[model samples]
Target: MIEVAAAIIENEQGEILIARRKKDKSQGGLWEFPGGKLEPDESVEACLKRELREEMNIEIQPYESFGVNEHDYGSVHIRLFAYKATFVRGEIVLVDHDRVEWVRPKALKAYEFAPADVKFVELLERE
Candidate 1:
């Protein structure tokens, strides 16, 4: 399984941060929670912090484990860990994704998110 760590970053206005995948990427043109694959010897927290920095150029203080989901992309299987986090510092500078947005949970369904993220979006809507 490919281990992945992502954050559910909530802004002061109570909107969640979502990143848009580049058209050439695997899950091209889909929106997703910002994160990356976990590396060897790295804890989920460390992986999250590192990914946020590398992918978005921002820092966050991860709070609790929000949820987990798994997805099968034919040849690849991914196990995703979601965490609730608060933005700590830096302006978001997108490096991997093409766009980013702060959206309300109710509006989540309006965007085409990765399959793995759909469950989390449901969880958010239910809560």
Candidate 2:
């Protein structure tokens, strides 16, 4: 199973960051809490930080665990670890994604998320 780390990054204005997958990638065109799979020997927090920097060109400080979800996509199974995070610095840049948005938690429901991210979205919407 792939171990993925997802960041529930919120800005000072209380808006959360979400990214749209590149159209050519797996689960493409869906919005997701920006993050990526963990690399070997990497801590969950480290993975989250690295992924946000590498994929989104932003710095973040991941905090407490938010939740976890396991999903199977036929070809792959992933265990997603969600963590609450705060944006630290840097301008946003899209690398692995097509677009990024800072949205209110309740407003997240309007976007279709990857199956693995649905649970996180639901929980955020309730906050």
lDDT on C-alpha atoms for all candidate structures: 0.91, 0.94
Model 2 whole-model lDDT (C-alpha atoms): 0.94
lDDT of 1: 0.91
- Model 2 clash pairs are none
Maximum-TM-score candidate: 2
Candidate 1 Cα misplacement greater than 4 A, ranges: none
Candidate 1 lDDT over residue span 13-108, tens digit each: 889999999999999999999989999988788888999999888998888899889999898999999998888889989888999999998999
Model 1, C-alpha of 87: deviation from truth (Å): 0.8
